[model samples]
Target: MNAVGVDVGGTKIAAGVVTPEGKILDEVRYPTPHSPGTLVETIARAITEVGDAPEVGGVCLAVPGLVLAQENKVVYSPNLRAVEGIPLKDELEPKIGMPLTVENDGNAAAWGEFRFGVGSEADHLVFVTLGTGIGGGVITHGILMRGAQGSGGELGHVTIQATGPRCACGNHGCLEALASGTAIGRRARELAVEHPDSALGRLAARRQILGEDVTELAREGDEVALSVLDEAGRWLGVGLAGFINIFNPEVVAVGGGVMEAEELVLEAARKEVILRARPPSRDLADVKVATLGPKSGVLGAAALARDASSREYLLGG
Candidate 1:
């Protein structure tokens, strides 16, 4: 049976009806609403629009927040604050007329990669997305490791440097604070002030330096811009090395806007991993770019919905 996956992002919500084989049969996108009532309605609309087929069995929402899996609710989401404290399953299930569940967006993306993307060939995988913030999830022994509170795979919050910049989560020296796209932009702006004649500096003089601008400048061989990415990549590597030691995943898949720089960023991260990560696990992990890109959350959530449907059938039988 097919299932519906809803990716509730900060700016928009995307829902897709996906087959067991991972093909998206139908999809819809809607701008995310900020109000609690409108947010629930928007999500319900997206699901119903995409999941018209009777073959679609269930649904899972991939949301940006600290989700309570058992309760199927979002407890906190800094990026999409309107989703906070909403009992999503309770609100959405009735509207969409299906069994629904909620998952952290990062976990959903990790599952997507494991099931259909770069990590499809690996039983153990680590997934990290470097966007406005750093989000990550882990699949070890073929299962997601959600902690007691359903916040287990929060890789970005780990402190790699005790004295680094502050993160959105208010933590200092967090991997997110150093390696996220937001961090890249912040770093780029800071460096532009030091090298006013550089391309990045010239651009920043006109307007704020975004993460994409940094990548563009680096591609043009701007030294200051390249250095900013190099620093962020090294910090990312520091975080990945710790994950390598703990989970020992076979593949570490990196995704998100920052990764558009590709080798410009990952080359440095790999070098750091080689230096810091220990023997077997370090040597075994293949750090690669995620294949699904922006669609991972939707695909992964659909997979989770399929899993939930199977579990329900077994429980009922």
Candidate 2:
């Protein structure tokens, strides 16, 4: 079967026609609009463009915010402020002329990974996307754990340091503040300024050094970059240790732009978790990099549509 999946990010809206096996057939992209109405229209247009084929079953939207699944509204999203409280499902269903499902982008990604990626073998899983900020999703017993308010798995917001750096959410020392890609880049840039003779400095001179640049530089034997990554990895490990203790999931899948330095990042994180987390929980949970990469969000959205349809069929039967 075919479905359209829309990934609504802060900067762009990407929609694709996907097969049941998670292969994308066709995709369309557009810059995200600043206004709520324009944004909805943009999404609708993209969905229509991608889902015009006769075989398309439905459309699924992956949104980066506190998604109220019951009402199909985005309750709170700092990145997409204009869309807060908008009735996304009600608006997009008629526009696309098909059944529709909406879910948190991270949750969609978790389900995607469960259905088609590395987590396919695991019944209980947690997916952490360490991008501009951190996003998380949890799956238990083959079901997505969207809490009562549809905002349960805000893992990044978990406090790592009681009196640490301030976060955008008005919290102290959130995992996002300490270990996210943006945090890693910001720290690398700061260190680059101090170590002008370092390779990191040279990379920064050519262009703004991103988190992946730091990891690549570190692999090439740059001390400053390695130091920064190691520090970030340790912080990530601390957070993951807590997660392991609490949930004891079967697998922890890490993704996002920063994960390009898989070994550099995961090794340090693994070391910390191994040292800190409870023995059996850490051992039982296999930590791996997300195999789906950037396509995860769209694929996850498509998976959401697929799963929803399957449930409907079962219920009707």
Candidate 3:
């Protein structure tokens, strides 16, 4: 069977046809629109394009923020201002003419990794995407954990410092405030300004220095970039340590653009987790990088639809 997976992100909308084996067949992409209506229309177009294929069974949408399952409404999305309370499934299902499922993008990505990627070997899994901010998902006993209000597993918002920098969420000292890709980029830019002679500064002079550039600089042994990544990784570890105590997942899969820094980031994060997390929990969890890359969200969304269809068929019989 096959499903169409839509990854509705802040900057882009990626849709793909995914088989039961978790392979993405054909894909389409478009820049995310400004308004809710346009966004939905864009998604509908992508689904139509992908579902034109013969084997497509359903559509799965991976959305950022809290989605109310009962109403299929996106309760709040920090990145997309126009999407709040929108009946996403109701709007898209008819347009696409297929059974549809909506999931938190992080949850979908985590499930994808669990079923097809790095976390497949572990029953308890946590996936943290270190993008502009951190997005997390947890799966225990092979089921997604959405919490009571469908707002659970928000690891990025977990407070690491009581009196730290202000977050976009209006909170102080949230993990996102300290360890997000945006935070990393912002800090790198600041350091570049301070140390105008730094190699990173030279790169920033030509164009806006991105988080990836910082990672590259660190890889090339630039001290400023290395220090920035270490600080960010330390904070990441601090947040994961708390999660380790609470969830005790068997595996923690880290992905996102920041993971490009590889050892530079992971080493510091590991150090912090070892120092802060409960010894048993820390020892139990194996931290690894996700292998699916940018396709994780779409692949996971498709998996959600495929799993839901199988379960429905089983129960119906």
Best by TM-score: 1
Full ranking by lDDT: 1, 2, 3
List CA RMSD, all candidates. 2.2, 2.3, 2.4
TM-score of 2: 0.93
lDDT of each residue in 86-163, candidate 2, tens digit only: 888888888878988778888988878887898988878988999988998998877888899788888889999999
Model 1 vs. true fold: TM: 0.97
Error of 3 at 238 (Å): 0.5
Name the regions of candidate 3 deviating beyond 4 angstroms: 201-208, 312-317
True-structure RMSD for candidate 3: 2.4
Tens-digit lDDT string for candidate 3 (169-243): 889999999998999998999999988889988887888888888988998999999999999999999988888
Clashing pairs in 2: none
Assess candidate 2 and give its lDDT: 0.88
Best by lDDT: 1
Give TM per candidate: 0.97, 0.93, 0.94
